[model samples]
Target chain A: MNSMVEMQNVIHRYSKNTIIDKVNLSIQSGEIFGLLGPSGAGKTTLVKLIAGILKPTEGTISLKGTALRHLAQMKNYGFMAQSDALYQELTAWENLDFFASIYNLSRKRRKERIRDVLEMVDLSSFKDQPVETFSGGMKRRLSLAAALVHEPELIILDEPTVGIDPVLRRSIWEELYELKEKGVTIIVTTHVMDEAEKCDRLALIKSGKVIALDTPQKLKEKVNVTSMEEVFLHYGGETK
Target chain B: MNTFHVMKRILIQFKRDKRSVALMVVAPLLVLSLMWMVLDHDDSKLELGAVDVPETMLEQLSSDTLDIETLSSSKAEGKLEEGTLDAVLYFENKEMSLLLEGSNPNAAGAIQKELQSLREDQQNMVDVEYYHGSEDLGLFDYVGPVLIGFFVFFFVFIVGGVSFLRERTQGTLERLLATPIRRSEIVFGYLAGFGLFTIVQSLIIALFSIYILEVFMDGNFLYVLIVTILLALAALSLGTLVSAFAKNEFQMIQFIPIIIVPQVFFSGLFPTEGLGTWVQIIGDIMPLTHGAEAMRGIMLRDASFADIQWEIYILLGFTALFTTLNIFALKKHRRL
Candidate 1:
């Protein structure tokens, strides 16, 4: 598979403190790549770096063999922030319509895409309701719909299912799998070990460093552990 | 094209928020009406007691602003002490001794002004002619234009600043940055979006003051609209730029004392002439100062566009400067 994203010695600093130390990764196309780490483990920062929302203080990042210097590079991916990020005062359709328009989709295409995403998220009935009236899970789903409205080739989700119920989480995962099958690159950041196992390849991050990078099954077999949590502990122990 | 979308989103959000629309258009009219009731009243006539005054002098003192009463010296002194008379003029041996109720300074000053004008009338008999405003022009008329600029600046600053701050705090700004939209597009979107409402707001407030409240307007209505719209644009851009430094809505409000109140002090509500040069220089930099100057020139002096063009340019400059700064400020969120 071709590498969809390649990071070389990416170091990000905020003022005097470094948040993302030198890290390197090559994410393959048509795969669900999971970034598994505990909270504040620089997972969000890493995804943001890849998404081109932030510039690294040192080193380089490139997407599709081109340097991530152009603003047009943002068109390649859809980002769902950890926060729902939906406009509370606007209805679900308005929110998705806004996101779609910003990506410069034509009015006709925007209408069609917005409907498709809303239906995919099972929020078709709630399309006219303002997001302020939505429950936590509903808002989350709407946020996902907003990200998908533009039909980007690469999807970057920062903890897409943090507070979601099991049934909804399963449905979202099923959606991710469908996107993967359609040759889309999905980058997901989650601390949940069970969720990490769902990705085609996993990068176990701890304290801003990648402890291990491999398929979940391979990492488990290498560590001689049946549970992904034990595999994480084994990898985490070796780094210490 | 992206800017149009952002503008549309803001208009939709504003439609959903009805209270903010009311606050922008109605609150200013309410405050202005209260000011008109207080400051636009006819001048109060002073109660003057004249004792042993000649008929000629009595007739001279007998003007509309004074209620002259002939009385004995003792009775006049008693009236003055009781605060029933503002002052008593005691004319004896061809000299005058004045007894005054000195407790309230405003009343005392009015009495003194009546006497001073009477003395001037005797010396020169000068006919007073107003070059711009009439003698009938009330305090509300003198300050009305400045208040119009002030209300527009204040409300636009608050609503625009708080809304932009909400975008940041709510994380929508971050989501917006992740899109392919340019940073300048976002800033321009806010300008155009908030700008439409400011245009409507300025029109309503200016028309209400000129037609309903009947504050003395001497210039073209279009000029007044132009000045107010530019001032509101300045406020909108400055508010968004200031929002970048603020962490929350409360912090955005904290800027009022630091940003809005000082502008009011310098906005020609009170004269800044006697103030130190540095103070006037600070006033010169404030957008409201330029706005108020242009507004006053247009509404009171019947100034042509060329007359207030310097103020117009300064106001436009402030808007441009603030807008550029706002574009730069978004770099803190996402560098493009």
Candidate 2:
């Protein structure tokens, strides 16, 4: 399978502190890839780099064989940051419509995609409600729906399920799997162990460095662990 | 086409935020109307004290417009110091000497005006020379155009700057950068979106000031709209640029004193002519100064488009420069 994203020697810094240090990783197409790390481990920064919302201080990030500097190539992916980022005063449907329109989808396509994503997030009934009235979990789902609205080949979600309930979280995971079956490449960042276990492959990041990279089963086996939590502890503690 | 999407989204958002809509449209109008009422207040009666004046002159001065009081010189000085008497007229020599309270320029101007007219009617006095503005000019006629440009620029600057800053703080701007949209497109999208309401705002305020409030409107209405709109554009661009430096809404408000107040001080609302050359240079750098100057030129002086063309270009130049800086500022978030 072709690599959907390629980060070579990516080094990102804020002021004098290095956030992403000389790291390299390749994300294959049509797989659920999880970046698991503790808080402040630069997971958000690295994901933002891949989503083309930020630039690397010392290397290159390419999406679909094209450098991110070419803005046209960025349309191939959808990005969701930790924040819901919805227009508070606008209705949920209007927010989705705005994003869909930015992608230049046909009016019919825009309506259909908006309906599909809202249903996928179980927010179809609340489409006309203003986003300010939405609960935290509802807003998170809406943010997911917006990221999925354009139906791009790649999706980058940063802590997408942080505030969601377990049942709704399971539903969202099922939807993400369904998209993966449709050949969409998903890159999700999370500190949740069970969620990390769901990814086809995991990159265990610690202090801005990816300490281990493999399938969850293989990683656990290599660490002589039964759960991803043990594998994370093994690496996080061993590094010290 | 992409710009239209951004514009549409902004308009939709505006529809939902009724308070912001009212603030942008109604606040300026309310303040301006209040200013008109104050500036266009009916001429006030003057209190005059006659100290050692002939009874004939005292009788001439005693009318509905002037209330003359007979008092000793010391008593007259005390009354003037107490702000009771507007002025005290005394005759020590053949030459006339008038002691004015001198506080409140408007009251002083009123006293001077009444005395000038009194002198004229009594003796067919020394011929008064004509100047740039006729003697019939009211304070509203002089300050209306400045306030018009000022309110538009002020409100648009605050609203545009704060909204753009919110986009940053709320993470929407980062989300926007992730899309295929160019930085310039985002900036232009905001311009087109905000630009629509700005035009409407300018039209309503200009028309009301001219037709309803009866401010001086000697030139083309179209030119007035054009100047006001350009001033708004300058404010919009400068405001967005300033927002990049501000981290939050409070920091944005802090800019009012630093950026907005200086412009008002020299926007020709007061007499900038008496200011030193270097101080006047500060006015030249302020967009409001040029905007107000152009507005006054068109409204009061009947200046044609060609006459105020330089100011229009300066305003446009300020917009272009600030917009370019804003686009460059976006590079910090996303290099492309």
Model 1 residue B310 CA deviation (Å) reads 1.1
Show the colliding residue pairs in model 2: none
Instruction: Summarize candidate 1's per-residue lDDT along B1-336 as a digit string, tens digits.
Output: 888899999999999999999999999999999999999888788899999999888998898899999998899988878889999898989998777888989888988888887787766776789999898898899999999999999999999999999999999999999989999999999999999988899999999999999999999999999999999999999999999999999999999999999989899889889999999999998999999999999999999999999999999999999999999989988889
TM-score of each: 0.94, 0.94
Residue pairs in candidate 1 whose N, alpha carbon or C atoms collide under 3 angstroms: none
lDDT of 2 by residue, B118-236 (tens): 77785666677644456667899899999999999999999999999999999899988888888998898889999998999999999989999988778889999999999999999
Deviating ranges (above 4 Å) for candidate 2: A238-240, B71-82, B90-113, B116-135
Assess candidate 1 and give its TM-score to the true structure. 0.94
The number of the candidate with the highest DockQ is 2
> Could you give the CAPRI-style class of model 1?
high
The runs of at least 3 residues in candidate 1 whose Cα sits more than 4 Å from the true structure, single-residue gaps closed, are A237-240, B47-63, B67-95, B119-124
Cα distance off (Å), candidate 1, residue A81: 0.2
Residues A63-98, candidate 2, lDDT per residue (tens digit)? 888888788887899999899898898999999999
Residue-level lDDT of model 1, residues A1-240, one tens digit each, is: 999999999899888878888899999999999999878889999999999998998888999899899899999999999999989999999999999988889889999999999999999999999999999999999998888888989999999999999999999999899888889999999989999999999999887788789999999999798989999888775654
The number of clashing residue pairs in each candidate reads 0, 0
List each model's interface RMSD.
0.7, 0.9
Q: After superposition, how far is residue B177 of candidate 2 from its true place, in Å?
A: 0.8
